[model samples]
Target: MQDITVISMIFTTILALACLFLILSPLFKWDTYIQVSSKGKDINATKEALLTTLNEIEFEFKMDKISHADYKHLKKQYETEVASIMKEEEELMITNIDRELKDEVEKEIEAQMKTYKNKKGEGK
Candidate 1:
């Protein structure tokens, strides 16, 4: 009877701990591979998925499930998709950097113009 009681207590403790972890799970964040932007993340995920699928198709061709001609076609399509996604990501990064630099330059130019105007007014 004591053994049963001990087992029940242990089970209850484990259940409580599990509930606690579940409740706190959202509070503890871990590094995630998922991108924050849906468009970017979906594009990246599609690229990765295509790469894996291309590899699998190659394997299937070797196993006689897919013919060489069909494999070539499928591989080309996947490669094109991955390439397009990579290009988009690259362009997005370049545009973002350019925008940041442009903003910084504009701010500096404004500050310099203000200083020049102030100096001219003081000299007059």
Candidate 2:
């Protein structure tokens, strides 16, 4: 029927656009797609997203949906991205831990100073 043909064409166009968006999304880094999710916008989240995308690409390749060249290119790009994301996360975690330790040490020193002052007063 004419109606069925029209609907099928519309569906095909939508599917093609979705594929294009998926292909271009990594290059452009769609902010909303990656940021506004439940996982959050941290380095870990970004790495997870990249991993998921990489897995999807692998699955698609296995299913014969994508060409070998495209699969190879996308896989390499995603792996590089994931490595950088994890490296940044590791550095950030180290900095946070260092800052927390310094704060705790300062607090302990202040408490010790107060105790020393109290002891002096008692001796006098």
Candidate 3:
């Protein structure tokens, strides 16, 4: 029947479009949460996960689900991990700033040399 044919055509068109979209989505970077391997991002994610786990561990201890000895061990371990992560994050930021400053200074020096050369050539 004509109705059946029309329905099939419509469905085929939709399927084709869906396939095309899936194929192009990655090329266009339509994914909302692209995982980047930057040190800062990893540090923040690790810190957040550790903090969440610490909160859960504390709650469990309060609810009498964990022994005092075990709770203390876990809390101390996680606190130490968080502290290290924070220190690393700070160091990464300082390193990044220093690198950017170096780059900027190099660029300025290059620009000044170019300008000086141009002026010297024009005076000849």
Candidate 4:
């Protein structure tokens, strides 16, 4: 009977410790809960947020909930921000395309050089 109680107590203690560790593990690794965002993704998210704001502003203006002057100012500001984000996205796309093109061109050049060398060797 005493041996059974001791075994039960040890099992309960181990189970409690395991449960506590499982519950607190995420707290120790809080940084992993956050996702790392790239610059292009950030720009796209900002643009989407700005567009939503613009839509809300337009709705408020149409509903006569905002002054004409305020609507114009806000609309202009948000539009400018959206345009800037779009330009940045376009530039990022162009940069990536250029890098890919350069890599492809290099690979093609290497392949052609190899073919030419093989043909010359065969002739000899």
Candidate 5:
């Protein structure tokens, strides 16, 4: 009876430690959560700012306070600015995706290398 209680206590402690390690591992090891959250916030802010600028430009054009040439020039400027922002956002997204893919590929290569080493060791 005492042996059974000791074994159960040891098993429970080991299981608890394993669970704690699993929970804390990601917190110490990676920035995936932070990076993704920051990117999402930045993209949302940029989109909102661009939309506000576009609405203001349209309102001014509708009010007819500016001449046709001025309106055209301003519209072109806004379009260019918005397009530049979009391009930058797209590039950032692509960069993030590429980085993740590269990491995955590297991990796969490392796993393959480990497998090869194990096989070679077994053959020896």
Candidate 6:
């Protein structure tokens, strides 16, 4: 009975550790991937929301629910909103790429500077 209890305890401890590791692994390993995926999802949702709003505005205009002048103004507003959102998304992508490229170039420059300094010191 004592041997059985010991074996069961050992198995329980191992199982608990395995479960903990499984739960924590994604938090550490895939955090950045998850964040990027979430950002993409948000952008998609914003696009969909803007499109839906534009459709509604168009439907109201066609049904004569709004005056021609009002429809024209509202349509222009929606178009502007869509354009701004698209521009923001494009800017975000460009900024992310620009930042990464800048970081890489800075790292390369630092490495070259270090090498130059090392050679100068060696000559002295």
Best by lDDT: 3
Where does candidate 6 clash, by residue pair? Answer: none
Q: Write the per-residue lDDT of candidate 3 for residues 9-120, one digit (tens) a residue.
A: 9999999999999988878753335555465677798899999999999999999999999999999999999999999988988999999999999999999999999999
Query: Ten-residue segment with the worst summed lDDT in candidate 5?
Result: 28-37
lDDT of 2 by residue, 69-109 (tens): 99999999999999888877778779999999999999999
**Candidate 5 local accuracy as lDDT?**
0.85
Pairwise TM-score winner, candidates 4 and 6: 4
User: Candidate 5 on 1-124: residue-level lDDT in tens?
Assistant: 9999999999999999999999889778456766676876766687778778778877888898677888788878878887887888889889999999999999999999999999999998
Q: Model 1 scores what on Cα lDDT?
A: 0.88
Can you tell me which runs of candidate 4 are displaced by over 4 Å?
1-37
RMSD, model 1, all Cα superposed? 7.3
Per-candidate TM equals: 0.59, 0.60, 0.59, 0.71, 0.59, 0.48
lDDT of 6 by residue, 55-100 (tens): 9988998998988898889888878888887888999889999999
Q: Report how far residue 118 has shifted in candidate 1, in Å.
A: 3.1
Per-residue C-alpha lDDT of model 4 across residues 1-124, encoded as one tens digit per residue: 9999999999999999999999998779644444354556667778899999999999999999999999999999999999988888999899999999999999999999999999999999
Best by TM-score: 4
The lDDT values for all models are 0.88, 0.88, 0.92, 0.91, 0.85, 0.88
lDDT-better candidate, 3 vs 5: 3
**Could you give me the TM-score of model 3 versus the true structure?**
0.59
Give the C-alpha miss distance for residue 89 in model 1, angstroms: 1.9
* Model 1 lDDT per residue over 1-124, tens place: 9999999999999999999999998886533533454667777778889889989998999999988899999989988988988899899899999999999999999999999999999999
- Evaluated at residue 113, the lDDT of candidate 3 is 100
Measured on C-alpha atoms, candidate 2 has an lDDT of 0.88
Question: Candidate 3, overall lDDT?
Answer: 0.92
Output the worst ten-in-a-row residue range by lDDT, candidate 4: 30-39
